[model samples]
Target: MSAKFEVYLDHSGQHRFRLKAANGEIIAVGEGYTTKSACLQGIESVKANAAGASVVETDD
Candidate 1:
């Protein structure tokens, strides 16, 4: 009923932020950030712009 947030580090150690559905399928892969905080900010920004989505991190 609500969106979820997930975060991970890429092969380059950068942050990878993604939004997905509850079914474990990706909805959107946001631009990579140089820092975790930056990625988190991106997630927040995405969530503010969307709804009923989940965020996740993926390997590079």
Candidate 2:
């Protein structure tokens, strides 16, 4: 049981994706895209760039 990405259409019929943890909790969500391919590409981008991504606190 590992984290996985699930792609699907949103209520507005736009493509979106959610990253779910092993326990099935959604950990992250991607923005809506007009095409599924684009949505998948977004997932790939996250996979490619997230490993070394820096975490910084923002004052909000």
Candidate 3:
């Protein structure tokens, strides 16, 4: 299994998504949206923006 995004509904019936690893742990979570289509668009936005994203090293 590969890392994947899952969409689900909250208690308020708003849609949200989580990016989970194959081990079934959530690594990232998405914002709540009023509609499923918009939720999907959020996923697409992540896909589009993530490809070119750069990592920043945080000083400890």
Candidate 4:
């Protein structure tokens, strides 16, 4: 099966988001939102940091 990722903001308008797969499996969860711009920048940082990284999938 293939998985899709998503992003969201917390109730407090904080970027305390969670990155999960289409199957609802959590990949990563974090909180770092002092500002909206900073939150977006943090997302970019996560993607950049993941570039060329290996993705390990385990069978359920």
Q: Which 10 successive residues of model 3 have the least lDDT summed? A: 51-60
Model 1 residue 20 CA deviation (Å) reads 1.8
Span of 10 residues, lowest total lDDT, candidate 1: 1-10
lDDT digits (tens) for residues 1-60 of candidate 2: 999999999999999999999999999999999999999999999999999999999999
RMSD for each model, in Å, please?
8.4, 0.5, 2.0, 6.1
* Candidate 1 deviant stretches above 4 angstroms: 1-3, 51-60
- Candidate 4 on 1-60: residue-level lDDT in tens? 455334566777776556777777988876758676776677678778888789899998
Q: For model 1, what is the error of residue 56's alpha carbon versus the real structure, in angstroms, after optimal superposition?
A: 25
Quote model 2's TM-score. 0.97
lDDT per residue as tens, model 3, 1-60: 999999999999999999999999999999999999999999999999998999999998
TM-score of each: 0.69, 0.97, 0.86, 0.56
Which ten contiguous residues of candidate 4 have the minimum total lDDT?
A: 1-10
Which runs of model 2 end up more than 4 angstroms from their true locations? none
Off by over 4 Å in 3: 57-60
Residue 36 CA displacement from its true place in model 2, Å: 0.3
Candidate 2 clash figure, as a count: 0
Candidate structures ordered by TM-score, highest first: 2, 3, 1, 4
lDDT (CA) per prediction:
0.79, 0.99, 0.97, 0.70
Count of clashing residue pairs in every prediction = 2, 0, 0, 0
Cα-lDDT of candidate 1: 0.79
Q: lDDT by residue for model 1 over 11-36, one digit each (tens)?
A: 88889877668877887787779988
